[model samples]
Target: MSIEHLRARASICALTLISSLTLASGCSDDGGAEESESTDESGESESTDESESTDESESTDETESTDETDTTDGTEETDTGNLSCEPEGDVTISYSIEVGALDEPPSVDLDLACTLAEIDTDGVTQVLILDCPELENVAVIDIAVSPDMSLPLVGGEAISMRYILEGPWWFNTYLRLDVEGTGHLLTLIDGDSLLPPEEFEFTSPVELTAVYDLCEPVSDGCGQRERLALMTTIAGEEAQIFDANYAEVGGEEGTEIWVGAAGHLHEIECTDTPDEWFQVLIVGPGEG
Candidate 1:
């Protein structure tokens, strides 16, 4: 071939080589840019996932701590017993007595006083106080029939007495009337004198006044029995005789009977049924 033709061919070959190199370089740069973008996207996703996981863990810990605090606070709230009923100040009691079936007005004097002795809450009854003996069982019979005639020993003479206690902080009041000495004769009467001996027998109904700290003594053989009989009334009975322990010997409801202490008839009452009488014993404070 000619020399000019050979030179032109060489030039065309050089230009084609340059063009191919430029295209290969451009394709490599595009691939690198795409890979870098993919790497950045993956790194951002990992960082977001880690942040969410940390927040969840912290939130769970906070919730657990709050729960523990609430439980601890609830355990410190219930400890005081029934001692909340104690009177904040001193209490006083005033009572009057009426002597029934006396020919003339009886001059009866009662110097009653109560002092706080102790606090007892264990047993069938709660809140029991020790009562002073001087203020507990004392029978005062101040009756004057006629200076002219000595009190007669007849069958139809009735003596009735009523007592009352007034106070702002009084809780529960109970009365106990004890009669001693048998030289003069005085017949006992029931709550209401309308019923006959067989119906509402003669049982004296005295108003019970609340005495502060008056707890029944456990040693007094018939004290509990006597208190129960006095609190309960029966119809058509003379006296209520119980054992020294006042545990109830047995009788029908509303029946009048006497409970004796050793040989002393210290309690008298008429009950509708024997069960009622026994119930009082069951609910009374422990004999301390």
Candidate 2:
């Protein structure tokens, strides 16, 4: 072969080698690009997952902190005690009356009134009123007696009496009796007296009860009606009258009594027959 022909063949071979090398370099670059893109995608997915995880953790922490703050704040959890029923301030007996027949047997009636210096939220009271009257010229008969000395009263041989208390709450009523006079008395009827002596905590009616002579009187029966007209203090503060009628009584036939937050007053009319007996009741409060 000629030298020029050999030179041309060598040139062609060189060109072919250069072309193959270039194609290989391009294929390698494409493979590297695909690998880089896959790595980028994986890194992005990992970043997104990490961000979501961090956000969830932060949210949980914030929720826990809020719960702690709420617990630390001052707030009542439960109620502790029961309500009380004792009187909050000073109390007074405002009025009283004596209930019963006059002739056959000297009957008795009692009425009482009270006042409060201040009202309380609970409205509970522990005060109890009692009746203890003096029998100066009083007489007792076995049967019911009328205002007139002539005939016995209507009911059977019973000394019927009743006591009532007026208040916003109707609590059970109770009575204590002390006889400075000359007789022993027994309670005839026993009502619901075993209740708290105080009024209800809310705005309600007060309780009241009247217990008649459960046992016989200390003395058999007196023949005269009790004449009680004296002054006594009640609840250690209020002033009260036993038998004497106040000016408000006026000239009424039956025993007219008025009781209010201020005090109690009695009214008795003078009868033509001096032999008639007068019945009166005095009420007060003490530790019981």
Candidate 3:
């Protein structure tokens, strides 16, 4: 009821109000702290998600590199070089021998082995290249004579043989035979001259036999020296005609020329050994 008492009561009321305001401010500060903590948690979650995304990208890059390596390995498994030729088949060669002229009866037929050797050459050694490896560069020609066959009045018999080289490539080429032990290249043809389609009407061997068989006056013109010269002449004309005879070069005027040609041809290895059997290999240009 006094003035001092009233002042003291008013001071107490002011102190209470100040305390209430301080408590309210403290609560507001606590709420702001909780909000800030929640925001920090959210930031951490986003950082973790970004790290997982980076890991996935690195794994994809490694997988792509592995695929590239597999592709490179596939390309290395295919590469080879040159190829060679091999033998495959064979062919037949037929030979017919007769003791008389065309359309003769009692003829003998012979067959020989021939190979279908396919090869490539520059046209020069086509025959040698096409022949079988066992008989390469060597020609083997044989004749079969039977007891039933008869020798006509004429000296030599008629003989023929056919050997077809397989394939279209051999049609345009030629067949050449190199005489064994003789430096002679003989081409077979069917004419009285050295040309295509090989054939022969008379051979040197037959003529040599005829020189002895058909000689009536063996003591005079058909002596051994004269017969040797005649044989040389026949052999020389197998490739070409020289028109060689005793009548053409018998006297002293032509004796030198005939003797010279005979000497040159006699040097051939074929003339060294004279026999009744004709040469099957040397298919010379004949007097058909």
Candidate 4:
């Protein structure tokens, strides 16, 4: 009886061991599948994140590029582009300029609103990057007339008005004028901002009735010596001032003739100034 019991117990134990091994193997396989699935999910998530990051990066790059392009376009418009260089009708440029006077008050301001008489393309136009906005449409008026003053113009008059551009950044400014020969400096600026002033004697208006008044014909009121001096002053050229023809106030000479008038080429007289004197109404160089 003891041998039989022992044999049966050994067989049962062996069967239990086999069953445990089988269950353990099945659990291992199931765990491996779960682990693989988890790894695959993690990989997918990383890939999605990378894709999103790449898209975002591309979007940011495009935005930056667009901004750069816009900035470039805007800068280009500022340099050479003008809202209106040529106004519709007669453009009356009202500006003030101040220059350093050679005399006292190194700062001499000239506030003048001159009518753009005509476009005199005798001077050169410079392509400068001004710090002022008003300079965007800068049409220089080179021919300026002298207003009918006590001491009027005998020959002609053309004081070049300069453009003064000055500000904090690259877009601010004013204007100025050192009245030729007068030495008295004047500017057409409103503020006290430091500016880089530039002058253009290039163009004038078509029909500008500038303040400059015509000179009087040589006469006793103007005086003989005075007329010669006037011609020399306005002609600008010392050589040519009294080089033109001359006439007496009266048809006849020795009528207490003080000086000479720019009468004509043929019908005229020579003067003591050596150079003949032909008087023009306008000063400087005027078309009329």
Number of the top-ranking candidate, with lDDT as the measure: 4
Please provide TM-scores, in order, for all candidate models, with all chains considered together. 0.15, 0.14, 0.16, 0.17
Structure candidate 3, residue pairs in collision: 188-198, 189-198, 189-199, 190-197, 190-198, 190-199
Q: Estimate the overall C-alpha local distance difference test score of candidate 3.
A: 0.17
Per-residue CA lDDT of model 4 for 53-78, tens digit only, reads: 00000010111111111111101111
On a 0 to 100 scale, what is the lDDT of residue 188 in model 2? Answer: 14
Candidate 2, residues 12-89: lDDT per residue as tens digits? 312110000000000111111111000100100010100000000001011111111111111112212332212111
lDDT of 3 by residue, 1-288 (tens): 332343333233121100000000011111111110001000000101001000000010111111111112101111112222112111111121111111211111112233322222222222121122222121222211111111111212112223221111001011233222332232221111111122312222122211221211112111121121223233233211111221222222211111011101111111111111011122323221
Error of 4 at 249 (Å): 40
Residue 93 alpha-carbon offset, candidate 1, angstroms? 25
Q: Give the candidate number with the greatest TM-score.
A: 4
Give lDDT tens digits, candidate 1, residues 39-88: 10010001010010000000101111111111121011222222222211
What overall lDDT goes with each candidate model?
0.17, 0.17, 0.17, 0.18
For candidate 1, the 10 contiguous residues with the lowest summed lDDT are 17-26
lDDT of 3 at 13: 16
* Candidate 4 segments exceeding 4 Å error: 1-155, 167-171, 191-288
For model 1, the stretches where C-alpha displacement exceeds 4 angstroms are: 1-110, 113-120, 124-233, 237-242, 245-260, 264-288
Model 3 worst lDDT run, 10 consecutive residues: 16-25
